[model samples]
Target: MTTINDIAKLANVSRSTVSRHLNKNGYVSQEAQERIDKVIQETSYLPSQSAKSLRTKKTGVIGVILPKISTETASRVVDGINQMLQENDYQMLLTQTSLDKDKEIAFIKLLQSRNVDGVILLGTNTDEALVNEIQKADVPVVVLGQNMPSTTSISYPDYNATVEMITYMLENGYRDISFIGVPEDDPAVGILRKKAYIDTLKKYNLPILEERMAFGDFSIESGYDAMQTIMMHSSQPNAVFVVTDNMAVGAMQYLKENHYSIPKDIGMATTGVSRLSKYIEPVLTTIDFQNEDAGIAITRLLMEKLNGYNKTKKLTHTYRRLSGNSL
Candidate 1:
């Protein structure tokens, strides 16, 4: 309930003097500064965010738009962003679009209306209209985990990385591989991984069997269902490369319940290896994408843009692989 006026009256100074001292924008006599500090400590008066933003045009807030941040990978990305923003004294406003294009656009517009200093978008596919809108607003928008033209972006080498892994598997004498993946129609999640699977098969002169490729919803349940269907086939794959660790775990559970030995009976590998992977029977042989680094880098770029220091058209992020037991 204490206002600047109350502090000014108690200190016998103008409200402007108190405001300057609080913002560190101007100096005050030692006695006046001491009195103001004492009054502030006693009253615990905090400035209104709206009023401060109105005066400085810097809200000290950043917006993060993610697609299904509940997942382990997405959560790690959020943690990285939070750590960086906390260090920089900026708060985060998070929204999940569930990978819906319309919802994502709406969220971006809403954040813009709120005058957020910057925005970091996760798992976004390029859209020219969206890029144009972001550019016209003169707001710094950093796209994370996907490449986009005409905007700053940080992306992992997902397609090529998968291709490399699959190539390695084939060269090492693994055949009859089943790829459990999300639907390719979903550009942000499935297209890249599916493409890698198909391309690698073609490069190695392997028969691309329609029955061998199964689509899932990137969930453990979906993975279980897909694996069940694959098992029903007359010929089973010798190895399975699941696109996500969650799905891989589900597949492994199904295999275990059905008494299908792991690695001994069939080989398995997945994209991410979280804590659960180690405890799981065969310990997933997966690639560590370093999602936390991606998150930190994106936040840093957003902060730079917020501070008016970044003037680049685009930025890209890369990834590394971590080998484990299942492969």
Candidate 2:
């Protein structure tokens, strides 16, 4: 019910002075600011976001496009984003694509139409069309998880982390380590992770066998099916390195159903050091990508762009290896 006009009259100042005090733009005398603050506190007055946006061309909100909202990675990253955004008086508008690449493209346009100040994409693949759209969009966009050459991104050290993990496996005497991974369409988890797995094996003079690799869709059932296919080979693997913790759990589930004892009959390791990985049976040896830190970094980078410091930035985050009984 209280408007800026009412506040100006009550504070004994011109409406323009009240505007400067409310918007924190231009200059207001210290005494006038004090009187306006007192009147605002007494009236519990709130500024209209629409009016502020009209004046500043910013909605005071950020749009986030997630591949899937149900995963531990998504939750942790969102928590970190919220922590930073709240401190800056910004709100978040979240949308889930359920891992649909087409939906990912659609949501970018949708968020832009909604007048979001910026967008943070929890990316999957770097499709050319998507990249071109990002290049042309009026709003600044930051990609997470996957790298795009000309865009601002906060990506994990997927290649190095996988190499480190595979090296650790080899050092522990896992010679015939089969990989359960998703398709190469997802450059971060699929292509890069698999490339590291193979390169590390070759570095140690290990055989590159076709039967030892299986592809999945980053699902538990897919992991189970991949494990089944891998087991059909005459020379079964002694260890398995899965691209994701979710898939690793799926593989473990299959191993259990077939009466295979973990670390005794077979060893396992995965990325994403999810909470469930620590609590699962036999525990999972995994890589902690520090997903929350990636979230915070992306938010800050987008904020910088919104503040007119526009340039392409690519930041690679670090990871930690979690020791567990599974390996």
Candidate 3:
């Protein structure tokens, strides 16, 4: 219930002195700062953000737009962002698209309208219209997952992760590998990942057959269906590589039902499902993109921009391969 005014009166300082000390907008004497700090500690006073925003034109809130809230990857990233934001006394305003591309753009505009300090987008694709909208927003925007040209982004090494994962499978005698990926529109999980798979096969002189390729949405059901289709191929792949661990779980579910022994019958490896993959029997081999670390890095970039520090256009994080029994 204590106000800045009460703090100022108790500290025996003018309101402007207290404002200067709290806002860092102007100078306050060291003597005045000591008194204000003492009073604040004793009173446990919190400033009115609305009143502060009126003076500084800042909401102290960062808008986060996610492709979907249900996914573990998205949730982990948001958790990291929240960790950083809270440390800096900034709040997050979250918007979920439920994997709808149109909503991604719409939420960007909505966040701008709400006068957020900045935006952190858990991007899926780099649509031109979406890019233009971000540029026009006149606020700092940092994207996670997808890497788009002419924009700031925090991204995983998708291509490398895929290559390493596929290569590991190949090294373990998996020549004919089936891939379950999202549509090509998703640059990170789709285009980059699939490209790595195809390129890796070519490197090893393995034929990239049409039957082994299956595309699906970011869902368990889609992965299940993709695996079913792959099974129908007369010459099915000896091993399967999925873009995400969530899909891998679905594929494994199908394999379990059909009595297919993992690694012995069909090896399975995936990317970015570290949390879920460990609990499943015969643990899943996956590339750890460090989603939480990616989230933390993106928030750091946003904070750099917000604080008038050096704005990094794009930042990349390394990926590590986790060995499991499934591969």
Best by lDDT: 2
Error of 2 at 34 (Å): 2.8
Candidate 2 Cα errors over 4 Å, as ranges: none
lDDT digits (tens) for residues 188-281 of candidate 3: 8889999999999999998989889887898888989999999998997789999999999999999989899998899999987656778997
Higher-TM-score candidate of 2 and 3? 3
Comparing 1 and 2 by TM-score, which wins? 2
lDDT of 2 by residue, 1-327 (tens): 999999999999999999988888889999999999999999999999999999988899999999988888999999889887997789999999988898888999999999998999999989998999899888999999988879999788999999999999999999999999888878999899999999999999999898999988877789889998999899899999999988898899999999999999999999987777777889999999888887888899998998899879998988899988998
Q: Higher-lDDT candidate among 1 and 2?
A: 2
TM-score of 2: 0.95
- Between candidates 1 and 3, which one is better according to lDDT? 3
Q: After superposing candidate 3, which stretches have Cα over 4 Å from the reference?
A: 309-312
* Distance from true location, Cα of 278 in model 1, Å: 3.2
Which number leads on TM-score? 3
Order the candidate numbers by TM-score, best to worst.
3, 2, 1
Task: Give the Å error, residue 116, model 1.
Answer: 2.3
Shift of residue 85 alpha carbon in model 2, Å: 1.9
TM-score of each: 0.86, 0.95, 0.96
Candidate 2: lDDT over CA atoms?
0.91
